[model samples]
Target: MLIREWMATDVLTVDENTSMMKALHLMKENKIRRLPVMSHGKLVGIISDRDLKEASPSKATTLDVHELYYLLAEIKIKEIMTKNPITIQPDETIERAAVVMLENKVSGLPVVNGKSELVGIVTQSDIFRAFVNITGIYRGGVQFAFSLDDRPGSIKEVADTVREHGGRIVSILSSTDMAVEGTRNVYIRIRNLPQEDLENLEKTLRQKFRVIYMVKDILKTV
Candidate 1:
């Protein structure tokens, strides 16, 4: 999925000259953690709640309420904001955005257009929601993990076996990262499986392949 389809378009932004107090207030009122700092309708910097907290007066400070307020008002967002922060294009894939976020150690990225105008924001929450949807977790199907050879038709064989047992496949994901050479790990999510047939299917699958794990709600049946 692309970022434009999932990113929050109605983003809350602040001017570079915005005071720390005002920025903090904006974050609190909107219930968001980060704000894109704009200058002359262009993206310039980014600030987050943590930055504001770090810039704030410490709890043990002897400064009075008026002094604290003055200090906050005098501090501009540009003073502590991350300059020229890492950004992602709206048309970029979600996986690319996730990679950028991981490499930068940031939770969110400002989405920009080709003209460099800020259009939206993509956060960790957005990526997580996309992952859940892609995995079909909410469909609540039985998930099976198997170790299979890397040769052609290996996945098809497992799928054919599942269908033969009257099980409907919901999703299938495979990875070679954790498998030994010449083999890969395949995870399949299936539904419409009868409880009485589960044991026999497991036994049959074990005979043909290595069944690594199975996850299902035992109390529920198709």
Candidate 2:
């Protein structure tokens, strides 16, 4: 999936000179953790809730409530915001966004266009949505995991068996990470199989392949 499909286009922004108090209010009102700082219609910086909190005066300060509020209003976002923050293009893949987030240790990214204009924002939640959509787990299905040979047609062989047993393949994910030499871990999710048919399929698969585990997942709550 692409970032544009999952990113939040109606993004809220603040100017560099905006007061910290106002930025905090915006975040609280919108239930957002970060805000892009804009200048002349271009993204100049990014500020997160953590920045605001750290800049805020401690509760044990001797200042009065009114005085503390005045201090916050005086501190500009530019003073605390991260300048020239990392960004990603809207057409980029969601997987790429996730990789960027993981590498940079950030939870969100500003989405910009080729012209360097902020068009949207992508967050960790959006990446998770893309992942879950691909897994087809929300729709309720059975998943079978196996250690298959790292060779061509190995996946097709398992898929063909499931098909023969009236199982509709939904998603097939494979990885070589932590697998034995010359082998891969394959996870196949399927739907539309009766309990008896599923059991029969498992028996047949175990007889022919190395069956690691099978899980019948029926979601009770989403």
Candidate 3:
């Protein structure tokens, strides 16, 4: 999946000179964590709720409530915002976005176009949405996992066996992360089947391949 297909287009932004008080209120009213900072219709910086909290006075401060409010209104977002923050492009893959976020220890990224304009934002929630969509978890109730040889025809052979057993494939994913050398871990999702047929299929697969596990009601909690 691509960032353009997953990022939220309708995102809230704040001006560079906007007061911290106004930014706080915007976050509260919209129930969002971050806001892109703009200057002359150009992307300049970004700020998060943590920045506001760090800029705020301590609870033990002797200053009165009115004074605290005034202080917040005087501090400009540009003063506390992250200038020239990390950004991703719309054409980038979701996997690339995830890597950027992970390496930077950030929960979200500002999506920019070729002209360096903020087009949207991608967050952890969007990443989760992409993962669930790719797994087909909501529609496919059962999943079969295996450690198969790292060869071209391995996946197709498994898929062909599934079809022979009246199984309709929903999604197929493979990874080499935890597999032994010369092998890859494969996961396949399929629609629910009758209990008897499902049992027979599992037994047959176990005999044919290195079956890791066959799970039913895979998305019961979700």
Candidate 4:
């Protein structure tokens, strides 16, 4: 999925000259954690709740409430915002956006167009929703996990078995990260099989492959 399809287009922003107090209020009012910092109609930096906390007076400070409020009001977002923040393009794939966020240790990203105009924002929550959609978890299917050799038709054999038993395939995901060399782990989501057929299907699959686990419902397993 592309970033444009999932990113939040109704972005909230703060100007470089915006006071820390105002920024904090903006975040609270909108129930958001981050805001893109803009200057003279151009994207310049980004600020998050952590930055606001850091800019605020420490809990142990001896300053009076009025003094603390005054200090925060005088602090501009530009002074604490991360300059030249990492960004992602709206046309980029969601996988690419996730990789960037992971590498930078950031929970969110500002989406920009080719001309560098701020278009939207993407966050960890958005990526998670994309994952749920990609895995077909919301459809509620029976899932089976297997450890199989990385040879051709290995996946097809499993798929054919499900099809033969009146099972409709929903999603198939495989990875080699946790498997022994020359073998990989596969998770297959299928639907339309009755509980009675599960026993025979499991027996048929175990004859040629190792069944790691099986779940009657994908949503519950997740």
lDDT (10s digit) by residue, model 2, range 140-208: 479999999999999999999989988888899999997899999999998857789989999999998
**What is each predicted model's overall lDDT from 0 to 1?**
0.92, 0.94, 0.95, 0.91
Instruction: For candidate 1, give the lDDT of residue 103.
Output: 90
Error of 2 at 17 (Å): 0.9
Q: Give the TM-score of candidate 1.
A: 0.94
Model 2 C-alpha lDDT versus the unseen true structure: 0.94
- Tens-digit lDDT string for candidate 3 (57-166): 99899999899889999999999999999999999999999999999998999999999999999999999999989988788899999999999999999999999999
Best by lDDT: 3
- What is candidate 1's lDDT per residue for 1-222, written digit by digit as tens? 999999999999999999999999999998999999999999999999999999898999999999999999999999999999999999999999999999989999999999999999999999999987787766746888999999999999999998898877878999999999999999988874667888778888899889999888444553
Give the per-residue lDDT digits (tens) of candidate 4, residues 126-199: 99999988888667467889999999999999999878877788899999999989999999987646678877
Deviation in angstroms for 172 in model 2?
Answer: 0.7
Candidate 2 lowest-lDDT run of ten = 213-222
TM-score, each model? 0.94, 0.96, 0.96, 0.94
Span of ten consecutive residues with least summed lDDT in model 1: 213-222
Candidate 3: global Cα-lDDT?
Answer: 0.95
Candidate 3: give its CA RMSD in angstroms.
1.2
Give residue 141's error in model 3 in angstroms: 1.6
